[model samples]
Target: MRKFDAIVIGSGQGGVPLAKKLAKAGWQTAIVEKRWIGGTCINDGCTPTKSMIACGAAAHVIANSQEWGITVSDFKVDLEKIVQRKNKVVESFRGGATKGMEKTEGLSIIYGEAVFTGEKTLNVILKDGGEEAITAPHIFINTGTLPKIPPVPGLDTIKYLTNTSIMELTKLPSHLVIMGSGYIGLEFGQLFRRLGSQVTIIDRGKQLLKHEDEDVAAAVKKVMETSGVTMHTGANVQKVEQIGDTIRLQFTANGENLTITGSHLLVAIGRTPQSTSLQPEKAGLALDDKGYFKVNDQLETNVSGIYVLGDVKGGPEFTHISYNDYLVLYKRLVNKEDTSIKDRPVPYCMFTDPQLGRIGLTEKAAKEAGYDVKVACLDMTRVARAIETGNTQGFMKAVINANDDKLLGVAILGPEGGEVMSVMQMAMLGGITAKQLREMIFAHPLYSESINNLFMTLEK
Candidate 1:
C-alpha cells in the first residue's frame, strides 16, 4: 500500500486547489481523478457551456443587427466550428490544471476511481487498468455530483442527452425540449434557441425559478418568452418515447394531457451527489436524505479526519462555493482559524441573454425571516446604459432592512447583471446601506449605475 499525508478523491474545484495547498505545505498528497482532470466546471459544466453560450449570443446579436442599422447580408451558425471552439477552450483549461498539478512537488495524480476500503485506506480501480491502495490520515472528498436522470417510462430506450452529453453535439438540434426550468434549463434553452433551434422548456413547478420572488421570476419568464423560447410550467412529465428520428414527450400541464415532439431531449431536472459509489459507509460517513454528505458547518463529515467539500456536500452548487470550501478547510486545518459555512452570503448568476444575478435573501425570504423589509426596484428600460445598448428587458431589485437601512439582498436581471451584482456583493460585504448606495456616485451609463436608481425608488 502506498501511503500519503493527505489523499483527495476527485480533482474538482475544491480538491485541485486543496491538494496543491496540502502538498505545498510540505505534506505528501495524492489526488485521484476518475475521468477529467478539472472536474465538471472545466471539463463539462461552466467552460464548455459558457463558450457555447457566447457563440449563441454572438449569433443572436448578428441576426438582429439590422435593428442597429447594420446591414448584414447572410449569417449561419456553424455547429462544427462552435463545437471545435468550445472543445479548444475546455482543453486549454484542462491542460493548464493538469500542468499545474504536475509541476507541484510531493503531489501524485492517480487516475482512478477511489473507493474507501477502510476509514483511512482507499482502493483505486485504475482507469487504465490496475489496482492500488493508498492510505492517509486526512481524506477530502470533492467527488462532485452528476446530472440526475428522471425515472420516466421509455426513457432508457431512447437516446436522450444530459448537460454533459449535449456538449458533444456537432450539429445543431432541430428542436430542443428541455425538462426542468431551473437555471440550467433556462440557460441552455435560450442558448439553443439563439443558435436557431426551436426550444421549449417544461417545468413541474408553478413558476420558473420558483425560489425567487414572484416579480423576479416573472421578469425572467417575460424576457425568455419575448425571445421566442416557449415555456410550459406546472408540467409533470409522464413518459418519453422515441418516434423514429424525433422524440415524443408526454406531460400533464394545467390539468391537460399534452405531448411535445422534438429532435432532442435534455434532462436537466437536477444533479445527484456521487457519494453512493464512494461507499462512505466504509469511512464511517453518512449521507443526508437528499444523498449529500451530511457535513457540519466546518464541512467535516461524521468521520473525524474526513472532510467533504463542494457539490457532494450539496448546498449551493456553484464553482465559487466549491472554492470557498477549500478556503474554509485551509483556514481551519492549516491556519488554525475559526470559520464556517453558516450564514455566508452565497451569490450566483445565470448566463441567460439578460443574465440573472442574485445574492443573499429574496424579498420573500427576508419576510419569512421576520425582517421589516423595504424593497426597491428599477426597470432596465429606464437605465441609460440599457437604452443605449438596446438590451432593456429586465429589472434590478434590492431588499433592505427597514430598521437599519442595511442591504439584505439584491437581484439584477439585466445585461451584464452578474457583474452588476458583484458590485452589490462587495457593498453588502462592506455593510453599505441602501441609502449609501443610492447617494453614491457611480460611473455613468453602466448597468451598475442602475443600482443608484434602484435604491432611489425605495419608500423612505
Candidate 2:
C-alpha cells in the first residue's frame, strides 16, 4: 500500500495542472492515467482535429484562389501526409506536457487504471500487469469522457469510426457518412469535403446546431450545403451494415425510408462521462441523471475531499472550460481565494470556414429569461473586409439589454469569427454597452470593425 498527499485521476487539462500545482506547493501528489499523459484535447481531440482542419483550409484557399484572378491547376490532397503532420503536432504538444509533468517535483505519474475501493482508497491496475493500492486525503477527478456511441442494431457487427479513430485514416474516404450535425460532425464534415471526399451528414434535429437560434442554425446549414456536403436533417438512423468494402446506412425521414452507402461511417453523436470504471459508488460520489459527476458551483462532489473537473463534470465541454476548471480549483485550494464556476462567461468557436464564435445567451434565451432585449445583426457580405476577401458567407448577431443597453450575448458566423467574438467577450466582461461599441473607434476594414456596423442596426 502507498499513500500520497493528493491523488489526481486522469491527466486532462484540469488534473495535470492541479497535480502540478499541488506538487509545487510542497505536497506529495500522484496522477493516475489510463493512457497517454495529455488528455483527449492534446492527444486526439482538439489538437489533431484542428490540425487536419487547417490542412483542409489550405486546400480550400488554393482551390478558390481563382477568385483573386490567380489561375492554378494540379492541386492534390496528400491525406497520408496530412495525417503525418497532424501526428507531429499532437506529438509535439503531448511531449511538452509529458516533460513538464515528469519534471514536477514531489509528483509521481502512475500509468494505470484506477478504481475506487473505498471513500479514500483505490487500487490501480498498472499497465505492467500488476496491482497497487493507494490512498489520499484529497482526490481530484478529471477523467473527461468517452465517445457516446448509439446502440443501433448491426452497429456492433460492422467496423465504424468514432471521432478519434476517424482521424487515423491515412487515405481519404471515397464517401464519408457522418452522424450528428453538431460542432464535431460539422467540423469533420467540412474538413473531409475540403479534402475531396463526398461527405454526407445525418442528424435527428431539424436544425444543425439545435441549441442555437433558428436563424443562426439556418445560416450555418446554408454555408455547409453550399460546400457540397449533403445534409439529412430530421432523420432517424435505424441500422448500419458493411458489406465488401461498402458501408450502408438506413434511416427514415418524414415517413420515407432512405439508405446511404459510403466508404466510411463516422459516429460523432456526443460523449458521456467515464464513471463506471471509477466505481464512484464505492466512494459514495453522486452522479447526475446523465452519468456526469454531480458537482456544485465550487466543483466539489457530494463527498468531502473529493472534487470533479472538466468534461466528466459536464457543463459546456470545451478545452478552455476544462482549463478554466483548473484555475477555479487552484484559486480556492492554493491561493485561498473565493472564486467560483457560477455564471462565468463561456465562449466557444466552431472551426468551420467562416467560423462561428459565440458568447453568452442567444436572442431566444434572453427573451425566455424575461430580459427585454434588442437584437443587432449584420451580414458578412456587407463587411468591407469580408467582401474584399471574397469569403463572405455568414452573419453576426448580438443581443443587448434593451433597458440598459448593456451587452447580453453575441454570435459571429464569418471569417475568423472566433477572433472577432473574443473582442465581444471582453466587452461583455467589461460591461461595455451596445451604444458604446457603436460609437467606438475601430481600425478601418478589420473584421472586428464590423462590430460597429452590427450595433448600428439598432438605430436604423
Candidate 3:
C-alpha cells in the first residue's frame, strides 16, 4: 500500500496542471495515466487533427489558386509526409508536457488504470502486469471520454476508422463515408475531400449542426455541398459490410433504401463518458442520466474530497474548458477564493475552409430565453477584404439585446472568423453596445472591419 497527499487519475488537461500545482504547493502528489500524457488534445483530438487540417487547407489553396490569378498545376500530395508532419507536431507537444512533469518535485507519475476501491481509496492496475493500492484524502478524476461507436448491424464484424485512426492513414481513401454530421463529421469530411477523396456524410438528424441557428446551419451545408461533398440528412444507417477491398454502407432516406461503397468509413456520432473503469459508485459519486459526474459550481462531486473535471463533467467538452476547470479548482483550493463554473463564456470554432466561430447565445436561444433581439448579418461577398482576397465565402451574424443594445450572441463564418468572433467576445465581456461597435474605428480592409458594417445593418 502506498500513500500520497493527493492522487490524480488521468494525466489530462485538468489533471496534469492541477497535479503540478499541488506538488509545487508542497503536497506529495501521484498522477496515474492509462495512456500517453497531455490527454486527448495533445495525443489525438486537437493537435494532430489540426495539423492534418492545415495540410488540407494548403491543398485547398493550391487547388483554388486560379481565383487569385496564380496558375498552380501538377501538384502531388505526399500522404506519407503529411502523416509524418502531424506525428512530429504531436510528439513535440507531448514531449514538452512530459518534461515539465519530470522536472516537478514531489510528483510521481504512475502508468496505470485506476478505479475507486472505496471512498478516497484507489486500486490501480499497472501496465507491467503489476498492481498497486494507493489512497489519498483528496483525489481528482480527469478520465475523459472515448469516441462512441453505434450499434448498426454488422458494424462489429468489419473494422472501420475512428477519428483517431483515420489521422494515421498514410494513403488517402478513394471514397470516404462518415456517419454523424456534427463538427467532427463536417471538419473531417471537408478535410479529406480537399485532399482528393470523394466524401459523403450521413446523419440521423435533419440538419448538419442541430445546435446552430437554421440560417447558419444552412450556410454550412451550402459551403460543404457546393464543394462536392454529398450530405444525406435524416438518414437511418441499416448496416455495414466489407465486400472485397471495398467497404459497403447501407442506409435509408425518405423511406427509400440506399447503399454506398467507400474505401474508408468513419463512425463519429459522438463521444461517451464511460464510467466502466472509474467505478464512481464505489466512491458514492452521483452521476447524471447521461453518465457524467454531477458537479457543483465548485466542481465537486457527491463525495466531498473527490472532484470531477473535464469532459467527464459533461457541459462543454473543450480543451480550454478543461484548463479552466483546473483554474477554478486551483483558486478554490489554493488561493482560498470563490471561483466557479457558473456562466463562464464558452467559445468554440469549427476549422473548415471558411471557419465558423461561435460564442454566447444563438438567435433562437436568445428568443427562447425571452430577450427582445435584433439580428445583424453581413455576407462575406460584401466585405472588402474578402472580395479583394478572392476567398469570399460565408457570413457574419450578431444577435443584440433590443432594449439595452448589448451583444447577446455572435456567429462568424468567414475567413479568420474565429479572430473576428474573439473581438466580439471581448465586446460581450466588456458590455459594449452595438452602437459602440459601429462607431469604433477598426483598421480598414480587415475581416474584422465587417463588424462595423454588420451593426450598421441593424442600427440604420
Candidate 4:
C-alpha cells in the first residue's frame, strides 16, 4: 500500500490548494483526479465562458462603432478560432497547475478514480488498468459538481449541450434556446446573441435571476429584452425533439401551449453535487438533506480527518468562495484555528452585457430576516459616467439597515457593475457602515459615483 500523510480527491479549486498546503507544510500529500487537472473553473466553466463572453463584447463594440462615428465593414464571429483560443487558455493553465505540483515536497499526483476502501484507506483505479491502494491520516473531498440536467422528456435522445460541451462547438448555432434564466443561461444567451445567434431563454421562474431582488431582476429583464433576448419566465419545457436538422422545444407558459424551435439547446438549469459517486457513507460521511456534504462550522465532515468545502458544501458556488474555503480549511488544518467558514459578504456576478453584481443580503432577505431595511435605488441612465460611456442602461440598488446605519446589501445591474460592487463587498467584509460608504471620496463623473448617489437617497 502506498501511504501518505494526506490524500485529496478531485483536482478542483479546493483540492489544488489543500494539496499545495499539505506539501508545503512538510507533510506527504497526494491529489487524485479522475479527469484533467485545474478543475472545472480552469478546464471548462469560468475560463471558456469568459473567453466566449469577451468575443461577444468585442462584437458588441464593433456593432456600435457607428455610434462612435467609425465606419465599420463586415464583422463576423470565427467560432472555430474562438474555441481554439479558449482551449489554448485552458491547456496553458492545466499545464501550469500540473507543473506547480510536480516539484512540491513529498507530494504525489494520482490520476484515477478513488473509492473508499476503509476509514483511512482508498482504492484508486487508474486509467491504465492498474489498481493502487493508498492510506492517509486525512482525506479532503474536493470533488466538484456537474451540470444539473433536469428530467425533461426526450432530452436525452436529442443532442443537447451543457456548459461543458457548449464551448467545444466548432460553429455557432444559427439559433440557440437556453433552458434556464439563471446566471449561466443569461450569460451564455447574451454572449451568443451578441455574436449573431437568435437566442431565447425559457425559465420556470416568474423572472430571470429569481434569487435577486425583484426590482434588480426586472431591470435586467428589461435591458435583456431591449437587447433582444426573448425571455419566457414561468415557462415549463415539456420536451425537445429533432425536427429536420432543427430542435423543437415544447413547453407551457402562463396556461399557453408554446413550441420554440432552435438549432441547439443549452441546458443551464444549475449544478448538482458529485458526492453520491464517492459513496461518502462508506467513510462515515453524511450528506445533508440536499446532496452536498454535511459540513460543520469548521468545514469538517462527520468523519474525523475528513472535511468538505465549496460547492459540495452548498453555499455560494463562485470560484472565489472555493478560494475562501481553502483559507478557512488551511487555517484549521495548519494552525488549529477556531475559525469556521462564517458570514462574509460573498459577491456574485453575472457576466451579461453590462454585467450584474450583488453582495450580502437582498432587500427582501434583509427584511425577511427581521431587519428594518432602507433602500436607495437609481437608474444608471442618470449616472454621469454611464452617460459619458454612452451605455447607460440598468440601475443600482442599495439595501441598508435603518437602525444601525450599516450596509446590509448592494446590487448593481449596469456597466462595470461587477467592478463597482467590490467596494461594497469590502465594506460588508470590513463592517463599514452605509453612512461611511456614502461619505467616502469618489472621483467626479465616474461610474462608481453612482454608489455614492444611491446611498445619498437612503432614508431613515
Candidate 5:
C-alpha cells in the first residue's frame, strides 16, 4: 500500500499542473495517467490542430503569391509531411512534460487507470494487468472530453473522421463534407479549404456558431463564404453511406432533398465527458444528469477528500480555464489559500479565418440581467489601421451599462480578434470604464488601437 498527500488523475492540462504545484508545495503528490502525459490539448486538440492549420494557411499564401507581387511556378502540399511536423510538435512537449515532472520532489507518476475502491482508496489498474491500491487525503479528476458521434443511421458504415481521427488523413480530399457548424467543424472547414479542398458545412441550427453574438457569427460566416466554403443551416442529415469510392451524405435543407458526396465525412458535432470509464459511483460520487461530476466551489465532490475539476466537472471547456481551476483548488487544498470560480470574466475565442473573441456579457445578456445597456460597433473597413493592413473584414463591438457607462462586454470579429479582446477582458475584470478606453492613447498603425475609436463612436 502506498500513501500520498494528494492524488491527481488524468495527466492532461489540469491534472499534471495540479500535481506539479502540489509537489512543489512539499506535498506528497502522485499523478496517474492512462495514456501519455500532457493529455488531449497537447496530444490531439489545440496543439496538433493549430499546427496543421498553420501549414494550411502557409499553403494558401503560396497559392496566392501572385497577389503579393510574387509568382510561383510549382506548388503542392505534402499532407503527410505536414502531419509529421504536427506530430513532432506534440512529441516535443510530451517529452518535456515527462522530463520536467521527473525533476520534481515528492512527486510520483503512475501510468495506470485509477478508480475509487473506497472514498480515500484508489485501485490502479496497471498497463500489464497488475493492480495496486493507493490512499490519498485528496483526489482530483481531470479527465477531458472526447468527440461525440450521434446515432445517425449508416454513419458507422461510411468512413468518417472526428477531431481525433482526422489527423491521420494522408491525402487531401477533393471535397470534404462537415456535419457541424461549431468551432471545431468551422475551424477544420477553413483549414481544409485553405489547403485546396472544397468544403461544404451542414448544421441543424438556423445559423453558424449559434452560441456567439449574431453579428460576430455572421461576420465569420461571410468570411468563410468569401473563401469558398459553402454553408447550409437548418440542415437535417438523414444518413451517411459509402457509394462506391465516395461517401454520400443525405440531408434535408430548406425543404428540399439535399445530397452531397465527398471524399471524407467529418462528424464534429461536439464532445462529451470521458468519465464513463472511471465508474465514479463506487466511491459515492454523484455525477450530474449531464454526465459531469458534481462539485462545489472549491472543486470538492460529494465524497469527502475527493475533488473533481476541469471538463469532467463541466463548464467552459478551455485549456487555460482548466489551468485556472488548478490555481483555485491547489491554493485552497495545499497552500490553505481560499479561491472560488466566481465573478471572473472568461474570454473565449473561435479560431476561424477572421477569428472571434468575446468577454463578459452581450448587450442582450446585460439588458436581461436588469441593466440599461448601450451598444457601439465599428466596422473594420472604416478603421484606417485595418485598411492599411488590407484586412478589413470584421467589426468591434462594445456593450456598456447605460446608467453608469461602465464597460460590460466586448466582442471583436476581425484580424487577431482574440488578441484584441484581451484589452476589454482586462477592463471588464478590473471594473474599467468605457471612457477610459476611449481616452487612453493607443499606439499608432496597429489594429487594436481601433478600440479607442470604437468606444469614442458610441452614440449614447
Candidate 6:
C-alpha cells in the first residue's frame, strides 16, 4: 500500500497537466494510465486523425494540381507511409508527455488500470500482473471516452472499424462505408475519399450536421458532395454482415430498403465515456443519464475532494475544452480563485478540407435562447483570399444580438476557417461588437479579412 497527496487517474489532457501542476506545487501526485501517455488527443483522437487529415489534404492538393497550372502525371496514396507518419507524430507527443511527467518532482507515473476501492482510495491492476493500493485525500478522474459501437444485428459477427481501430489500417479500402454523418464520419469520409477510396456516408438524420444551421449544413454537404463523397441521409441501419471479402450493410431510407457493400465498415456513431471500468459505485459517485461523471460548475463531483474533468465529465468534448478543464481546476484549487465552467463560449472545428469552425451559439440556438438575433452571411467567393486560393467552397455566418450588435456566435466554413474563427473568439471574449468588427482594419487578402465583409451584411 502506498499513499500520496493526490491521485490522478488517467493521464489525459486535463489529468496530465493537472498532475504536473500539483506535483510542482510540492504535492505528491501519482498519475495512473492504463495505456498511452497523452490520452486520446495525443494517442488516437486529435493527433493521429489530424496527421492523417493533413496527408489527405496534401493528396487533395496534388490531385487538383492542374487547377494551379501544375501537371502531375501520376500520384498514389501510400497508406503505409500515411499511417507511419501519423504514428511518428503520436509517438513524439506521447514521449514528450512521458518525459515531462518523469522530470517533474513529486510525480510518479503508474502504468495500470485504476479502480475506486474507497472514496479516497484506488486499487490499481498493474500492466505487468501486479496490484497496488494507493490512497490520497484528493482524486481526479480523467479516463476520457471510447468510440461507441451501435448494436446492429449481425454487426459483431464481422470485424468492423471504430475511430480508434480505423487508424491502424495500413492499406486503403476499396470502398469505405461510414455509419454516421457527424464530425467523425465526415472527416474520415473525406479523408479516405481524397486518398482515392470510394466513400459513402449514411446517417439517420434528414440532413447532415443536423445541429448546424440549415444553410451551413447544406453548404458543408455541397462541398463534400462536390468533392465526390456520397451521403445517404435519413438512413436507418438495420443489419451488417460479412460476405466473402466484403462487408454488406443493410439500411432503409425513404421507405426503400437497400444494401451497400464495402471493403470496410466504419461505425462512427459516437463515443461512450470511460466510466464503466472505474467502478464509480465504490466511491459512491453518481453518473449522469448519459453515463458521464456528474460534476458541478467547478467540475467537482458529488463526492467532496473528488473531481472529474474532460470527456468523462461530459459537455463539449474538445481537446481545448479538456485542456481548459485543467486551467479551471488549477485556478480554483491552487490559486484559490473563484471560477466555474458556466457561461463559457465553447469553440470547435471540424478538420474537413474547408474546415468548419464554430464558436458560441448557432443561429438556431441563439433564437431558441430568446435572443433577438440578426444573422449575417457572406459567401466564400466574396472573400479576396478565398478567390485568390480558388478554395472558395463554403460561407461565413455570424449571429449577432440585434439589440446590442454583440456577436452571439460566428461560424466560418472556408479556407483557414478555424484560424479565422479563433480571431472572432478572441473578439467575442473581449466583448467586441459587430459594428466595431466591420469598421476594424484587417490585413488585406487574408481569410480573416472576410470578417469585415461578414459583419457588413448585417442590418443596422
Q: Candidate 2's C-alpha lDDT?
A: 0.93
Residues 1-460, model 4: lDDT tens digits: 9989999898888788789988899989999999998888898888778988888888888988998788798787899998888888888888999998887878899999998877889899997789999998888888888999999999989899999898888888999999998888988888888888899999999977877888888888987787788999999999889998999999999999999999999999999998988777778788888799988888888888887767888878888888788888888778888777777558888888788988889999999999998888888877989888788888888888889888888898889898888877887778788778788898887788777778777643
> In angstroms, what RMSD does candidate 2 have relative to the true structure?
0.9
Pairs of residues at least 3 apart in sequence or in different chains that clash in candidate 6: none
TM-score for each model: 0.99, 0.99, 0.98, 0.97, 0.97, 0.99
- Writing each residue's lDDT as its tens digit, candidate 1 over 1-460 gives 9999999999989999999999999989999999989999999899999999999999999999997889789998998999999999999999999999999999999999999999999999999999999999999999999999888999999999999988899889999999988888998999999999999999999988988999999999998898889999999999899999999999999999999999999999999999989887888888889899998999988888899889999989999999999999988998899999998989999999899999989999999999999999899999999999899989999899999998899999999999999999999999999889989998887778888888889755
Cα misplacement distance, residue 370 of candidate 5 (Å): 1.9
Q: lDDT of each structure? A: 0.93, 0.93, 0.92, 0.87, 0.86, 0.93
Candidate 1 pairs with clashing backbones: none
Q: List residue ranges in candidate 2 displaced over 4 A.
A: none
Cα RMSD for predicted model 6: 0.9
| Model 3: CA > 4 A from native | none
Location of the lowest summed lDDT over 10 successive residues in candidate 3 = 274-283
> What is the alpha-carbon lDDT for the whole of candidate 4?
0.87
Model 6, span 140-198: residue lDDT tens = 99999988888899998999999988999999999999998889999999999999999
- lDDT (tens digit, per residue) of candidate 5 on 290-358: 788988888888888888777888988888888888988888876788788877568888787577888
Candidate 3 lDDT score at position 304:
89
lDDT of 6: 0.93
Worst 10 residues of 6 by lDDT: 451-460
Q: Local error of candidate 2 at 337, Å?
A: 1.4
Model 3 over residues 1-460: C-alpha lDDT tens digits? 8999999988889999999999999989999998999998899889998999999999988988887788987698888899999999999999999999999999999998898889989999998878999999888889899888999998998879888999989999999999999888999999999999999999999877999999999999999997789999999999899999888998999888999999889999999895667888888888898888898999998888888889988999998899999999988988899999999999999888799999999999999999999999999999999998887889999999999999999999999989999999999999999999999999998998889999999856
Candidates in order: C-alpha RMSD to true structure = 0.9, 0.9, 1.1, 1.4, 1.5, 0.9
